[model samples]
Target: MAEQSTSAESTESRTVLSWSGGKDAAYALFELGTDDVTELLTTISENGRSSMHGVRQKLYEKQAESIGLPIRFVELPQECSNEEYESRMADVMAEYESLGIERVAFADLFLEEIREYRENQLAETNIDGYWPVWNRDTDEQIEAFLDAGFRATVVAVDGSLLDLAFAGRELDSAFLADLPENIDPCGENGEFHTFVWDGPIFDAPVSVETGEVVTREVGDGKFHYCDLW
Candidate 1:
């Protein structure tokens, strides 16, 4: 964890971060500096799990407690359509606008279409979009994350890109060294997703135990998800 300077900046705006309970989101929050961030926002499915990571709501609540930030969960029905998702998110943004929040941050690395979509969504409301770590080299970002003492575990893996064995491993140098050349070091291309347990942004480590790894079939592909509790 990097030591934060007590000096105040005059240009800081109240920002809310899109939290996925994953490494990139944690690292983005760390990069954004928590002083200006007002809350962490996550989308939860009807099954009580995070949207894509499949993390339990209870674990995310624990994460928020350890990170010393309030969190807001946007509930979505199973197999929500894009229009419905947008409408719900617009409502959330309106609520944030009412609270005087000026920006919403995301952890997008180099996904141009994703960023564009986020920006377009925010454009409809008074709040603007913020990207703390954007267009940076994925390899450097991953190295910097580890070098800064951020510890995370791989909790979800795209079975098509990686083996099931990679689902529950820690995100460390050894893991990086073993990754195939096509895989992004930071998993920026969705090769995998991680749960950050300890880092500079956290007041303390989130205590969790890895459970069973299960393979689930989604539309056309299979995903390996490691249960964490």
Candidate 2:
């Protein structure tokens, strides 16, 4: 395992990363600049699948083990309203507060609405919010992520915006070069989502295999997800 910085260890406030098992989140953890990470926080479906990425629970466990951190999976039903989601998250934040974690970090990049929502949600709570990669240029951000020796694969792609073939591709220079002009280099616009398998923050690589490419309708659009196992 990589040794943590002294500054991170000496801090008083316990912290947690809002882990999404994606490239941006992985890169945020790498640049976390603090060694006091208590746990990873993620949302999962009632059936135990990752809420957005749709990755299996076992893989998430493997990821946590590789990162040497326990994960808190907030379970919710497949379909939920914003109110229900917020209520469940508030409960989880209460638990974190009881555990003495006063801060939570995210990897959000230049999304005003998302940042506003997050900040507003936490405004009334003891636990504060952090955005590690707030407004950096998407191209530079992704190049830095790759240059830092992180390896990830595209696991989900918006079928409306991206070709199905883009799914399961590694997040490397070649892949970035191939992205359409409309897609964000860091996929900040939800054009794609990734799963990090190896990185500076991990003790070892998580082995995974790509499964079938399946399309599913979400709201008014359809998405093609490359399942990983």
- Cα lDDT computed for each candidate against the true fold: 0.85, 0.83
Model 2 pairs in collision: none
**lDDT, candidate 2, 97-118, per-residue tens:** 7767788998999999999999
Per-residue error (Å), model 2, residue 4: 26
Model 2 misplaced stretches (Cα beyond 4 Å): 1-13
Q: What is the Cα-based TM-score of model 1?
A: 0.93
Give the lDDT of residue 158 in candidate 1: 94
Specify the highest-lDDT model's number.
1
lDDT of 1 by residue, 41-156 (tens): 88888888876788898898888888877788888887989998988888878767777888889999999999999988888788889889999899889988999899998999
Q: Supply every candidate's count of residue pairs whose N, Cα or C atoms clash at under 3 angstroms.
A: 0, 0
Candidate 1, poorest ten consecutive residues by summed lDDT? 1-10
Query: For model 1, what is the error of residue 209's alpha carbon versus the real structure, in angstroms, after optimal superposition?
Result: 0.4
